[model samples]
Target: DASAMDKKQKQFDKLINEWKQKCEDITVELEASQKESRHYSTELFKLKTQYEESHEQIEALRKENKNLAEEIKV
Candidate 1:
C-alpha cells in the first residue's frame, strides 16, 4: 500500500509540473500577442493621421487650381 501511494504521489507531482510549465508558456504567448497588438494599433493611428493630412492638402490644391483657372479666363 505504501509503495502504491508513493507511485501515485510521483505521478501527481509530474502532472503538476507539466501544468505549471504550460501556464508559463501561455502567459508568455499572451504578452507577446499584446505587444504585437499595440504595435499594430500605433501604426494604424499614424497612417490614419497621415491620410487625413494628405486629404486636406489635396483639397487645398484643388481649390487653388480652380481659382487659377478662373483668373486665366478673366
Candidate 2:
C-alpha cells in the first residue's frame, strides 16, 4: 500500500510540472502575438494616412483637368 501511494504521488507531481510548462509556453506566445499586433496596427495607421493624402491629390488633379478642358472648349 505504501509503494502504491508513492507511485501515485509521483504521477501527480509529473502532471503538475507538465501543466506549469504549458502555461509558460502559452504566456510567451501571447506576448509575441501582442507585439506583432502592435506592429501591424502602426503599419495600418501609416497606410491610412498615405491613402488620405493621395485621395486629396487626386481630387485636386481632377479639378485642374476640368478647368483645362473648359479652357480648351473656349
Name the top TM-score candidate.
1
Candidate 2 residue 59 C-alpha distance from true site, Å: 0.7
**lDDT (10s digit) by residue, model 1, range 1-74:** 99999999999999999999999999999999999999999999999999999999999999999999999999
Q: lDDT scores for all predictions?
A: 1.00, 1.00
- Residue 28 in candidate 1, Cα distance off native in Å: 0.2
How well is each residue in 6-57 modelled by candidate 2, as lDDT tens digits?
9999999999999999999999999999999999999999999999999999
Candidate 2 Cα outliers beyond 4 Å, as residue runs: none
Off by over 4 Å in 1: none
How big is the RMSD of model 2? 1.3
TM-score of 1: 0.95
Residue 72 Cα positional deviation in candidate 1, in Å, after optimal superposition: 1.0
